[model samples]
Target: GAGVSQSPSNKVTEKGKDVELRCDPISGHTALYWYRQSLGQGLEFLIYFQGNSAPDKSGLPSDRFSAERTGGSVSTLTIQRTQQEDSAVYLCASSLAPGGNEKLFFGSGTQLSVL
Candidate 1:
């Protein structure tokens, strides 16, 4: 896909299990972001990565969640010991620049379900 690509479009796991979600952004994009959106809720920022610099993970719900961007292109989000409440649609987006407003290209998203 020329736009952002996400793998395992849907995931189902038992409580306490671990899952890894992958996102491959468009080539040459410098900024990438992860967001979580539960049913009927708005997008919740999870993390932001800009180039080789440090990532902002303040939006992570808990210490069990972590993400890393490799080569400023592909980013992976890891959730350890998943809970039922963690079920949501995980969205990945990329922008040419970092800011509140930019032309962001979003992926189809990974829907996670914890049973």
Candidate 2:
């Protein structure tokens, strides 16, 4: 793809249901990141993957949230037992480098809404 791609741009699920958001990063990019942007809130880092290894996953609010990157390309974010407070835009970004503040290309994101 020319840029990052995300699936199910808008999702409405009942509380306690589980949802999975997908992200496909640019080809040849070695770094993938997941972030959450709540209304009026700045982007919060959820996880980061360099190559095939994840060096950070500390930003996830709870154990109900998890992510993984496969083959150094696509990534998925799974939210279990969704709560009303979990509503937000799940954004995915990709960079060419492994560290530092490299320019990131972001997807449109999946807006998860827990009703």
Candidate 2 deviant stretches above 4 angstroms = none
lDDT of 2 at 48: 91
Candidate 1 stretches with Cα past 4 Å from truth are: none
lDDT of 1 at 15: 100
lDDT per residue for candidate 2 within 7-59, as digits (tens), equals 98999999999999999999999999999999899899999999878899989
Model 1 TM-score?
0.94
TM-scores across all candidates?
0.94, 0.96
Q: Which ten residues in a row have the lowest lDDT in candidate 1?
A: 49-58
**Cα lDDT computed for each candidate against the true fold:** 0.92, 0.94
Per lDDT, the best of the predicted structures is: 2
How does model 2 fare in lDDT?
A: 0.94
lDDT of 1: 0.92
Worst 10 contiguous positions by lDDT, candidate 2 = 96-105
lDDT tens digits, residue span 1-115, model 1:
5999998899999999999999999898899999998878899999999985646888999999999888988999999999999999999999988877789999999999999
Q: Which pairs clash (backbone N, Cα, C closer than 3 Å) in model 2?
A: none
Clash statistics: count for each candidate: 0, 0
